[model samples]
Target: MLKKSDYRVVRALGHGSFGSVFQITEIASGKQLVWKRMTIVNDEDRKMALSEAEILQNNKSDYLVEYYGQFEDESEFYILMEYCEKGDLRKYINHLRELKAITSEDMLLDIFAQLTEAIFSLHSANIIHRDLKPENVFMTDNFIIKLGDLGMARVIMGTQQHLSRIGGTIQYFPPELLIQIEESEIAKTDLRPQEPVIQTKQCDMFSLGVIIYELITLKHPFADQNGEVLRTNIIKCKPNPLPNNTPESLKQLIMQLLCKDPTQRPSIQKNKKEKHQKKNKIKNQKKKNKKEKNQKKNKKEKHQKNKKEKHQKKNKKEKNKKNKKEKQQKKNKVKNQQKKNNNEKHQKKNKKEKHQKLNKEEKNQKKNKKEKHQKKNQKEKQQKKKNNKGKHQKKNKKEKQQKNKKEKHQKKKKKEKNQKNKNGKQQKKNKVKNQKKNNNKEKHQKKEEEEEKKEDEKKEEEEKKEKKKDHKDKKEDKDKKEDKDKKDKHHKEKGKDESSEEDKKGQVQHDKNKEKKEHHKEKDGKGEEKKEEKDKDEHHKDKKKEEKKKDKKHEDDKDKGKKDHHKKEEDKKDHHKKDEDKKDHHKKEEGEKKVETEKKEDKKEDKKEDKKEHHKKDEEKKEEEKKKDHSKKEEEKKDEKKKDHKDKKEDKKEEEKKDHSKKDEKKDHKDKKDKDEKKEEGEKKDDKKDHHKKDEKKEKEDKKGKKKEKGDDSDKGEEKSPNVVQAQDIKGDA
Candidate 1:
């Protein structure tokens, strides 16, 4: 049955646990309306919606979304509202995420202006938007921002009244609301809870602060680890500092809005007056000071001109004296340089003479040492030749006597030679054996030394590797710290740039105002100059007329001398009066002109200020664009840094992997060398055992067949004693 109506419910726009918003189209107008449907149709909810509708119906504003009508269906109650095509601010913020760009300041300012206007209107009507957030504010396709959601609004009057239940998202709750609730709960325990104190306009201002903070930073001011943490932090801890990039004006405004004490928050009227008065006072004082300074400077210049001629002669005398002094100083400087050069040349000559004398003394000492060494060598050679001549004759006589005795002793000598040869062979064997032992010991020592050297080299390499790793780690840490510092500095610079731009804009406006004032003054000066010229012309004409009258009276001077004199005196008095009147008129005209010029200048200043404001708006728009560009660049830089860091991390990982592989290779090489050394030691032990067994067999053969039994018995005895003692004795004999 409802399908045949003029309005058609297209779809649900939004839904909550107890209420839902439907997008409906009117068949006649083809316009859409958002229908908020409440399922739990209690008396309280109905009254709340009715009050909101009443407020909206009576208060008409461009900043506020219009309310249509409230109706009821079979199962639900529907409150109709103006359809905003662009939806709420929350959706817009989310949409911007896809674009990955922040909203411009112009858009923010537009929103703030509209919201402020709406708030002012609401306050005028004694209504406060207890819950004000982005979700409650809607925007149209044409960039019109409208405040909506009056479900939590309260009407303030003589008697404080509050809705029994608080309604708002926990995230956007102002500090006052929490305080009110706490106070109410305490009152309840004390049995004095007559009624909860009502919230004021300041509460809405607090919510506005949160919204502004969110808009500027693109994040909640009180966000924490999670929802619970956020609530705790908001209730207990102070909000974190806003981003350094936030504009100073916006930051200051938001801070004012966020004042925890309602009494401390800025009043709308007070803020406006303060800002305007400060601007006006600054402008006025600048103009007044400039005019006064100009007048003083003109007076000073006239006085200076009068004294200038009297000082000319003195100035000329001073100039001549200064020229003479400069020339004399230059001559003295030249003489000083000449003296320095002469001293330097004399010092150089003295140093050269000393160096030549030292070289001659060194050559003389070398010649004396050579002569002494040659004398000693000649004396020693003469003594040795004398001793050799005396010994030669005695050696020849002994040789002849020994030759006669040689035949008889020949046989005995041959036996002795045979025995000596055997002994010599034994000694040669012993020497060879000792040499082999020494060579073995030296080889072992060399091996040990080589092992120790290799160990030391490995330790040194390990230390070097550790130092390099530590250096690399420190460098990486320093780079990270530097990068962080650079980012902080860049953020601070961006903030300074924005503030400087604002200051420059303000200065430019002031300059334009000053120029307008100067232009007005110049026009006034020109007018005064014209008036002065006209007065001079009138005085000349009056003088001309009086001269003609005096000429006519000269003919009757004898007959009417006394009358003529009295008439002349009266005429002179009248002329003086006329001159005085003219002077008075001129003064009045100048004063009037000054007053009119001041008024005109004021108006011009106002107009100029308007234009400057418009220009400032344009500048602000440009600044918004600049800010967006800066944010984009910063984001790009952040991305680049992130990429660089990631690359560094990957490179570090690769380096670590390479180090691990190198460590594995070193361990494997060390293990292989250790195993080879152990194998060589085993072979040496086996060779020693074989040499011992051979020596034992030789001992048995040398004992002969008769004593073989005794040797075998001894061997058996040695074998029975222990292999260690027998091996030690055999190694010692070898």
Candidate 2:
């Protein structure tokens, strides 16, 4: 009979020899439960079920499944438990198909932690679940694992005695269980006993080790076969080494767990506790080391950055100082040049005044000499008449001479006044000339400075234009290369079609023949282009050279013009010297009145020699300036040649780089072709091998069918099931 109101049986989930588990719903609250039903007609089985229910109901832990209730019907007892939606660890293992999913180390560690907690809870409760396998471990949707089946579990202090019958699933049973029983009696009794032959904790540890090994390798450590084969292997064989993919730490732990003797297996709780302590220590140490490393790295980077900044600041200061010094020097030079120019203008003015004064003085001296001679002659005539004639006639002659003398004196006064006026006007004109010359020199200096600035701007503009042109040319070349690469890739992809591939192969052969011809054509084109560019460059260079020559010629003309101007100045200076000598002679004549004029003339002759010496000094200065300008021009020409040589070297380097790039492109194309060919060959070989294997399998199957047909009844009697054959083959192989 089934209960109608209290509990509702839903559907069977799974069944084993001892019990059947069902997904059930409570009638009162509609709560789901995994109902484990066991037929417990025997008193001992009933006691065991009741005991298990009591143990489950008493113990409450997140790591263990909760027991809801226990109830009995007419024939069977039902134990309701918490339903785990994700089923059990066996399903998880099967889903992943491996012990560890790739890149799921954290998930594995979490599983280990939960499993350990579950086992620890069972141990603390003084109960031992003798069977702990992947199938007995339940997992929730959140991946929480709980040890589930407790059919083989025993309470340490229970009134019931230990059973001689074996209990646990064979695959996970410890070695002691198998060894304790005789080989012949193994089939007659259970393989596991109710009471563990060894320490219950140690036995559980062995089971945990098997679980860990399975978790790591996705396969049981001793799973060599099925049925009796697996049982035999478990009894006789040592576990294989941990898989290559397992972490070294995890593998070592598994190896220790897989030890043959139960005593040799490490305690699970102790290992877990120790690992926890070690992990905490390592985490603390890592944090401390990271802090120290960061501090040291920061200090080093800061020091280097500071040093760099300091260096930059120092360089900037020095550069500023240098620029200021240069500016000051230029200012001083300009001032000195201005001063020199002013001095030259002043000297020219002084020389002009001196020459004008000399001419005026010489004219005055001649006029005075004539007047004195005329007066003397008139006086001589008066004396002669006074001696020969009477007193009245002498008186009349004296009156006439007095009137003529008065007229001559008036005329000489008028001539002196005119000469004074002329000298004053000449002095004013010389002053004006000096002022205008100073203004002209200042304007000329300003014009020269402006011209220099304009030249520098023009040079910068030309350089910018050249840079822009080079950039444009590079852009064009890059675009062309990109286009060529795209074309090549498209052609290669298209050429993979069989028909197109054949055509392409033929074309390639033709292309190889045409390559030499095309290469020659390209070479010719390149050569012609290079030659044209070279000619253009040479033409530009020649134009520059011509410009330089023109500049030099202009400089030479300027020098010649300066020399002519200097010669004119020298001639002017010589004239001034001559005038000064004449004036000196006139002064000496006036001072030495009675002394001979011959002395004055002799002094003038000596002054002429001095004038010639001054002229020679002026010529020497002009020659020195010419030499300096010529040397400066030579230096500029040499610098230009050096620049041209550097530019030529740069051009050669650029051309070499272009050649290297072209070669790289060709190599890359060849590499791509080779890779495609190799891939094609590999695919063909793989297909052929697969086809051959299919043919062999087909022949074998056909032969087997033919043999079966020859003795149908006999074959049926003797033949094994296909499943049995496969199982046997697996057993044999294992």
Candidate 3:
């Protein structure tokens, strides 16, 4: 739950489209840290931002900037990182350039060593910093190089050639990457470059060489040209020669690093091994020099000791002879000195008394002088204090005058600021008035547009209604003609049958009854079909009416919403009232829609039930017709058998006819059953097709919703990395 308000911003370090970086101090801890705030819009951006933090956290190098922690809110991701007070290498180089100074050879070597060590650490972790430049290399107070800004870094698995988009500073690009730049230019500008550049650890080494060359020369090795020419030079030409003062070894090393082919460039691992060997060789040479100097010193000391010993022996012999002569002379002097000592003691006593009297006199004189000096010192102190008091008074008066001037100046500034603020407020008020007038005009225009749309919709609805009515009238006319044709055919058939069956009146009457029954059944079936069609039409009409009502309600609601919004803007005092009214209106509309849908469903169910009942009645009529025909035939057979009293062959023929008639009846029943089964199967297939269509629509809608959600997640764009100054060796995870 780390909030932006928790830390006080000192100043903005950088700003870009992705987010901003700030130098901030935690209020509670009072520690100054760099706060990198990234605005992440999608999952990919979020992963990239988090990878930087992860790299900083996992990498442990003395030359890498430390990662503190990270936190995020809904849309913004934050990273707290160590603040490098001395800034970056680019700034340091620029500072040296400003001073017209170049880095010493030893210092340059030291920087190069640290950079190699950082790159070695990253390479060991299989990470390649594709954007290595002086700007991305940070420095500490003690000039320790910290490699950072891994925004374009990628991780490669073993032996995998990374295919990458060409980015980073082109001047530092190796020859292999630079060669692709020309192909991109020849390509259409509208299309993205198709050629892929292979990025590897050697790219970082080449960039390191460029940074070193720039550090020494205070310019790019491929400098003195635009980007295009520089890239071409990097690819097809050589870097400018190092200065004459540059050591042969360093010159050779830089040249090797700037090799056109990446394979020719020295690897960081090889450089590290060579550095260790050089250190050991230097140590051994220092030991040999110390041994040689110690041997020379020992030889000189021995030679000096031999000379001193010989000279000391000669001096000792001469001193011994002189001591013997002095001993005899000292004995004679001691005898005379005993007598002189007694005489000298009396004279010494007299002198001592005179000296004591003089010393007392001088002490009195000194006391008188000390008293005079005290009085003079007191007068001088009084005069100095008086002068100091006047000086203090003058100082206070000057300070008061300065304070008064400052107050007056501040007052004038305040007055001017207030006047400016008043003018600004008046301008804002005028702008608001103008905005209100524009809004009013826009609202009027919107109302007119809506009216026109509504009118067009009304016309379309009317046209649809007319078309439906014409279609219904046409269908009715066709049904009438079909009914008239059926009647005419029935009458003609009745006349023809009457003429053919004049003698067999009973049989004809029976046939006529059967025909009448069949005609009536046909009429009933047609009537049922017409009723079913009418019901279907009514159901369709109800659905259309419901749809039109819902549409109109939606339009009305939209118009009301616009009017309410306008009212709220014009009359802010009644905002709450209008909101309540709007809520009520929406609820009312929703309830009405729901009720209408329920009624439509009920009507559909009624139509289904009616069709089912009609089917059951038709089946019942068919069964009754079959029973009546069978009973009529059975009675006719009984009367024939009773009246004939004829041959066995006649009876046998009658039986055969009865059996054939039964077989025909059975065939007819089976055909009817098959037709009913087929009709049921067709209806089932139609229902299944409708269900499938609905499911497909639902799936499409779901896909659209998901797409919309992803679209909403795609925010403005990612941030441009300035100088992250955070380690990135192991975090790309590629």
Candidate 4:
């Protein structure tokens, strides 16, 4: 019933019908706890869980494990209990095997007593521990027993004799239940009467019997090859044979608890609890007796301790006095020894000083005698040096003359040898110089040939450039001619419009002259009747003539603007042509400068060749007299180097040939590129021209559209003009 979230799970201890048992820590208090988790998936499970929790919560005994709390969640319920440091009885029983199995009987009886007591308490509370096994019995670090895992426990009515339901581990099953299981299997086959088997308190005692035997012997009481064989043995009511060394009392207790008949099996009434009480009583008696004996021993130890203390104190006091006296005597002796040592040291130092003074005087006398001896030795050495100096000077003069004669003889011999070999050396030097000069000439000739080839290549390249330029220029010229033709055609069309305009002007003038003549006649007849009407008519005709003159002036202004625009365009084209021609002239100048630079470079190379030839001749003359490291191997290496150079030169020539071919291809590409560029430029120019022409046409169209609108407005204005004529007529009437 514990809240699972309230504890941090340390590790899982085990899992069974109730989900699992975990060693955990309570979060709030840092208390270690055990969680028995059981999922309450349905009301029946919930009810069973509540019953188990109730049985745990209501029960209280040192022999029975304590329940701390419980809680339920949506999916599961948890029962929190005291955490047993030592895990369970089964593990401890297994450990008994290593500790000597025979030593386990006493421990087993104690644990068995506790288990039986816990079961008695459960039975008294109308609860049956259906699954009593060694694993369900927990132990503490102090070897305290705790009965746990009441998950299979059931509550019974007060008058109920036993539980008729099946539960518990097979190995721990009582003989009665084994027989019942066998009977149930037979009943299923309709081979026997169907009798309900019930779990009484004897079942738990039987389990305790098994736990006891297992702890003492380190195995199950009815152990076989497997649970099934054990089950068959259990159904036959065949119990495990006890060893001969097993205590009679302990063996008898286990045998009686595991009796095949529940009626014959001893309940908690007179078995474990009574034995526990008797054991406790004996233990109390033993403790009392031990305490009495301990008290007597303490009194005797105290007297002995006091006597030893007094003797030690007497010895320490006398020893202290003796040590004091000894220390004084020793100190006095040390002082006397120090006085004696000081005296001796003083005597030794005085004698040493006296001896040192005597030695100094003796040393002084020896020094004077040595000085006299040294002075005499110095005079003798000076006399000897004077004698040896004369001998040394005469010997050096003879040796100097001998060396000079030898040097002169060697110089003459060298001069004669030089004279004898001079012609041969000169001939060899000339030959070496000639060879060097020939090598230089060959190198210079090859350089000149290469330079000539480079010049030829340059000429070819320049020719190709010129051809491409010419081709592009031709295409540009053609495009320009086509544009010129288009412009001329437009001009011819404009001329026709001008002639038509002249005819329209002539017709307008003739109409105006006729109107003037009519008006003059009207003026001539103004003296007659209806004079106002005549004046109105003449005024209207003059107004019409003025309107015609205004429209004609607008048309003439538009034509003048068009002509000025065309002239500006022609000037721009001429300026573009001049720019292109200037670019061509600059390019030609650059090409000529490049050619001149090539000639200058060739002349410089020739001068370098002449200097190198002179240098080579001088070097060869010097090299002929010097030892050179040239050998046949060196000659072979040089030949290899020459071949490599030749191969490189051939590769370079091939590459240059390919480059020349590529250059031809590139020139063709450049011609195409130039033609493309020229065409694009021409097209761009044409587009600009066409755009301008379109704009002009658009403007003309806009004008014509405006003229149409104007014509309509003119009709309106003309209609209104009649009103002006009427006004004039009105004036005439006035």
Candidate 5:
């Protein structure tokens, strides 16, 4: 269906030993793509070249290069794939190295993430990208990676391990693969039957680790020497440490990926999941930081507002004192004028000097009293200002200490959260590894058990068939013998002596009774065997049902666990929302209370200090009442939540009980039906046995009647001459 004429080659992209890649454009849509042309020399070469196209066609992923089509000519196999214009990761790494610059941690992590996704996609499809290297990874213009060059990738089925093959870059080969290769060669000399097979994905993981290490430090993690030295180094030597500048987490991840044992390497899915979790955590942290910043800003604004209110209050107090002093001075000046007028009137009537002397004395006394009052007022104002300043300073200090303590608490919480996350991740990794191992082991065991069961059943059925055939043959022989004996007895009764004929008749009757008894015994034995077989079959069926039920319960438990986890997360988010809402409400209420207090202070400005104090007390009482109400509401909400939780738990328990009861009922019904059917079958068998016994008895009675008739005929023959009878018997016997 594919034709090479549909695509026109633009330019050669790269060349390899077995293949060459070229940039190409489609004639129909003018879409550009990469054409990989492998020079096939034989059938094996062609098949190997076609494997990549087959794998890509069957499996598709966004991170991996897209497959378009494949075609082959006489000598070359051509496969078309998506074209990446920005070149490969190796070139990018080289360019960075040439510029003497280290790749940013974010960019490295992004590349690693993209590569992981691509690998995970391939792995999920059961295709191992054995040739994972920087050269195989291509970048788009936006720096997104597309994994290509899956020429060496192999698709494995089930849990089977692949044999070590000569593919992929030697520098990137994992220690396990390297050991497998060496052991394979050694096995030839040692005459060993099988060499250890390593997981192909781990080989890819090792390559990925090397690529990451190179990206970060622009150097290989392992020795890169030629020949045996490199092989030995890869097999035994540890990788070099990453640069100090690399993040601790990244360093740890790389080290784990480079572990010697294939089983120890972290799975790509785990890494992908962890990456997603990390991104979610980062986003949540950013949101929390923004909320905290907003809260801090609000606190600062409130503090500044409170400072401004205190400053305004101080100015108002100073201005009120100035006004009071001005009013007192004006009253004193008026009183002085009145006193002078009185003194002038008195001086005119009497002595002017006495009046002037009294006026002067009064003026001196008034001046002294005014001076003392001013000094007392100044001292009280100063003391009040000092007390207010001390209170403000104490409040600021307390706020600072609280802020510092909160910061410390937040830091500790973050540290604990990170530690818990780390521990959880490790536990999950171990759990997954253990689960995978157990599942694989169980699968293999189940397969073996099923095979053995099938074989045993086949053998049993074959044996039963052979036994049945033998039984049928014996029954046919017995039937023929009985017929021959009846004929002989008839002949004997016709011509033999009466006594001898009678004796022969009795012996035949006795043998017939014994044969019938034996036949009945065989039938009984067969019925019991059939019943045993039926019981065994029923037991097997019940066991299968129980196994199915157990599997279902296990699945249900997993689902319930996941549901519970999600529910808990949702509850935590809800509580966080409620707490934030409460904080906002409290802030709003505090602002309103401050405004009300300020308005009360303004209204009571002309009143005595005691009135202001009483108003403050009333405001405090109102605030306490509002707090009590909020607390009561909170308590009620908690109680309701508890009731709801209890109800939900009870409902779940009831549902479980109902389900269990229903299952029990179903089982009981099935058992009853089986019992009824078995009883019916047993009754039918009893009836059949009764009918067979009756038929046998009837046959026995008929044979007895015939024998008696023969005996009577023999008696009549006995009355005649014995010589004639003997002659006739001899003739009949001959």
Candidate 6:
């Protein structure tokens, strides 16, 4: 029987209106097969497909088809059967049409016989295959005809039923089915079944007649496409007549099948004997094929099973040998590990003991050596102190002797300085006495010079009176000469009053000559007056020169006195510098003597420091011994724990492990807080330090400024003091 799962699809065979057919392989035998899958979309369609599957399942005709199984799913119904390489009768007709092959009557008879057998089987089962066309009439690759696809086949068991349903290819539908369809449609709207649609198994016979017509004439019996034309043609029972070359007997059979009258239409030709023989032969042949295929499969399966069993046995033995060798190797490894562990533990124990003993011996030896060294150092310190005392006494005696000698020398130098001061005071008094005498002499000389100037002035006045008398006489002479010249010019002009133009010009020229002579006489009188004034100025300038000489002599005397005073002061300063230099030399000798004493003290201190360092070294040596003991004990215990132990290592690591991230988080938080605090504190401290430093700097600058001021004042001496004290006087002067 056909089933959805029974065949795997290979390729599409063909398709029709409602569903498609595919060439598939039967799953069980891997043989090529075909499945007629109808798309059954509703309950009615499913019911119809289910009924068809049942009908095909009930059929016992080899000539009908090889119905393997029937299957169905949500959307489709499938009927699995043998694959016909040549396809169905419709395809064969088309193939023949394409080739224009002349089909024989015998081939038609053969198909008719196969179809008759198929219909006979369906009828025996009380089923009517309402739709029968060339497409439904399939053939095998071997040219074996098979009638299949009972999708429209109906159950008509008891009476000739009235079916108003209309489905199937319209071109293949007989006239009777079309007529019933019309009546059924009419009956539906009219709401009556009074005149029943008389449908029966004979409708299938009519469809068969249509297929026969197509095979013979290469055309549909109705000679119209699937439309109203085909329906009307089918209803009118107007099929084209048979061809001229058609066997009359087959034609008559076809005519009988297509008769318009249902009662007149022929039933499917049935031959029980031939069907039995064919059925039996088909059954035996299938049994033989099945038996041969099973034998080949069983033989191949047995061979594979034997091979698998041998492989499994060989693997089991090898696995067992491998397991034994691995077990031995593991035993040896464990034993070696145990031995190594024991040896390591023993070695660690010995090492710990050796280290402890060695540390103790070294500590005792160091203590003994330190005690002996300390005693020796103490004796040396005592001897050094005695020797230092002797040297100190000797140095004190020498210092006292040097001090006496320095004192005597200082007293002698003081006597000489006092004597020098007395002499300098006597010299200053004598110089002052002489300057007073010189100033008195200058006063007397200036008095005498002033008296002489008065005498010279009296003498000059007398000389001026004599000169003035001479000048008066010269002026009188000049006055007389001028009067004479003017009278002469008056006479000349009076005489020329009546003269001619040339005579008048000669009179003017003579008057000009008289005027020139008077002007020369007047100039000579002025020259004599100027000479008298020049003689008076010469007497005044001579007195001025005498006064300038007296002033220069006084300034020269004052400058000489200032120079003498400066030279005396310079001599006193040089004597003082010499005395200071002698005192500095004595001080340097004392400082050198003090440095020698300090060097002796530093040597004693160095010896004391060495003793202290030696004692500290002894103490450090003792500490090292203690630490070594502690470390050795710790190592011994640690090694014991490590020896022959794997679990302890993990346990210790887990115990020692800490959440570093949490620690880091805490540390970071602490660090941040510390940094903030430090930054704040540092800022405050830095501020304080900066202020303190600034104050210190100011104090230092003040001290430096004061020192610089003092030094500058000393360098300028009374120069600055005079400027400051006399500032009021300077401002008044400005």
In the range 1-734, model 4's lDDT, one tens digit per residue, is 34566779899999776578888987655667887888777898888888778888899876677788888777888888888889897787667667764645566666766676678778888788888877888987667678988877877787645645577776677776666554432211113215656777777878878777777667666656553334556667567778887789888988898777778887777566776785585467557756985887688678778988999999999999999999999978985775464454245434664686579758866976886588669757865875586567558756865786587679768966975698589789989999998797667556645754664475467447645754764575566567877765565466446544643554454344434433333333333234335545644664575346435534544545565457446755864675576557656766887898999999989978986996797578546523332453365567657755865786687568758866875786588558645543444454465467557655665666757876566556555754665466434323
Best by lDDT: 5
What range of 10 consecutive residues in model 6 has the weakest lDDT sum?
184-193
- What is candidate 1's lDDT per residue for 528-642, written digit by digit as tens? 4554454456446545644553454344244445655674576567546755765675577679888998998998799789868967876786688568657866865686577
- lDDT, residue 28, model 5: 56
Best by TM-score: 6
lDDT values of the candidates? 0.65, 0.66, 0.67, 0.67, 0.70, 0.65
Q: Residue-wise lDDT of candidate 2 within 1-734, one digit each (tens)?
A: 33534777778888877789998776544567788889987998898788778878887766788887777887798887989889988787777774446427777876776777777777777777778888888876556676787877876664223343556766677776667644532331234545545435667777888887777677788765442325555677888787576689888777777677767877645576775774575457556756885887688778778988999999999999999999999978986775474454235444664686578758866876786588668757865664455456447656765775687679768967986898799789989999998787667556645754664475467557645754764575566567777775554344233222332343343334333332332324334344445445644664584355335434534534454456446755864675576557656655665465678778878878876886797678658856865786586568657755865786687568758866975796698558645643454454466567557655765667867665565445434543454355334323
Screening candidate 4 with a backbone cut-off below 3 angstroms (N, C-alpha, C), the clashing residue pairs are 1-70, 1-71, 1-78, 1-79, 2-70, 2-71, 2-78
RMSD of each: 58.6, 64.7, 62.2, 62.8, 67.4, 57.0
Q: How many backbone clashes does every candidate have?
A: 0, 4, 1, 7, 0, 7
Using all chains and alpha carbons, the TM-scores for the candidates as numbered come to 0.34, 0.36, 0.36, 0.36, 0.35, 0.38
TM-score-better candidate, 2 vs 6? 6
lDDT of 3 by residue, 366-414 (tens): 8747865875687578658756865785587568657866876797689
Q: What local lDDT score does residue 553 receive in model 5, on the 0 to 100 scale?
A: 37
Q: Which stretches of candidate 3 lie over 4 Å from their true place?
A: 15-19, 183-196, 225-229, 270-734
Clashing pairs in 6: 1-68, 1-69, 1-70, 2-69, 2-70, 2-71, 2-80
TM-score, cand. 5: 0.35
lDDT measured at residue 589 in model 2 versus the true structure, 0 to 100 = 50
- In model 1, the runs with Cα more than 4 Å from the true position are 1-4, 159-163, 179-197, 225-229, 270-734
Decoy 3 TM-score against native: 0.36
